[model samples]
Target: MAQTATTGTTVAEVMAELAALEDPRIREVNVRHGDDHGVNLTKLRAVAKRLKTQHELARELWATGDTAARLLALLVCRPKAFERDELDTMLRDARTPKVHDWLVGYVVKKSPHAEALRVAWFADPDPVVASAGWALTTDRVARSPEGLDLPGLLDVIEAQMKDAPDRLQWAMNHCLAQIGIEHAEHRARALEIGERLEVLKDYPTPPGCTSPFAPAWITEMVSRQHTP
Candidate 1:
């Protein structure tokens, strides 16, 4: 394990550890999802465990422009320490799916600016950014859907999901599945929209994995909720 300062560890040391941990097979698998890293997430989290919480170190690691490092940064960084605009800039720079997803899931989702960033990113013209927005919206759909317009979300998904880009379409499909699973009032309509759009219906899910297809995903999850 690398020695660390009280405030943080050196980026060089962390980068060295990451380099040693890289595996070609992992990188090959990650490339399918548009990520370029080879460091397994379980190993990466182990590194973060050694480094502990280090906001400044996280920033430095993120600045190194390495995918594995950025993933590590998301793990060790203090989420609430970031300013909203800083988080927005980070999102723009996170072009890879793993980094972007981790940033949103591990950082932005915990920030005070989550809702504000969600609104801004949702309307951005960039599909990748918009996907982040929808990702946040999906979280809200599952956890904090008090004021969200369920019908309106269904309307946009119905209107654009079929033609949306891959990432955006996936995000939209996830939100649709979430709405169907979480809100009984809209479950039938959610199923209807999913059936009509057929987004991700043929996605190649691994054995024992739930399909990303909205109708199947929603049905499976909702069934589990009702299981004894």
Candidate 2:
């Protein structure tokens, strides 16, 4: 493990460290996720651990135009420092699904403006923005369902989920699962929507993994929550 940098590090220094930690096999795996820099996640984490948290450094690193560095930026960024327009810029710069997912899941979801962004992005014309919106909504539903318009959310899913873009559909399906598992009052309605949409019905599930298909996923999650 690299020694933790006691002082602020520059983007150049972080890039140098990342270069030193590059591994071909790990890069191949990253490639599958649309990261071509071939930097291993373990190596990135090791470096990020050493770098600690430096919001300014994170922005500089993200500006260096490398996929792995951008990912590390998400790990170290100060979510509060990100204003709405900056986040919008970041979303525009997120050229691939992997980066988009990380920015939304790890960074945006933690921002103070998450709720506003979620509602706005869910309705955005851009698929990526809309996907992130739904993704954030899923997180909100799972973590803090208070004050959320659950019935309205379900109505949107019921009406538009079938025609939603692929990524949006996945997030919508996840939102349905979260509702079914966490909100007993809405579980039956969620299950009904799942049956009607039949989302991910034919999607393959890995052996020993629960299917993301809403009905099965809801049933499994509910069963686990009730167990013991």
For each candidate in turn, the TM-score is 0.96, 0.89
Model 2 residue 205 CA deviation in Å: 1.7
lDDT of 1 by residue, 1-228 (tens): 333479345778789899999999999999997999999898889988987898888898899999999999999999999999999999999999989999999999999999999999997999999999999999999999989998999999999999999899989999999999999999999999999888888889999999998999999999999999
For each candidate in the order shown, give its overall lDDT on alpha carbons: 0.93, 0.85
Provide the RMSD of all predictions against the true structure, rounded to 1 decimal: 2.0, 3.1
Candidate 1 segments exceeding 4 Å error: 1-4
Q: How accurate is candidate 1 locally (lDDT)?
A: 0.93
Clashing pairs in 2: 27-38
Pull out the clashing pairs in model 1: none
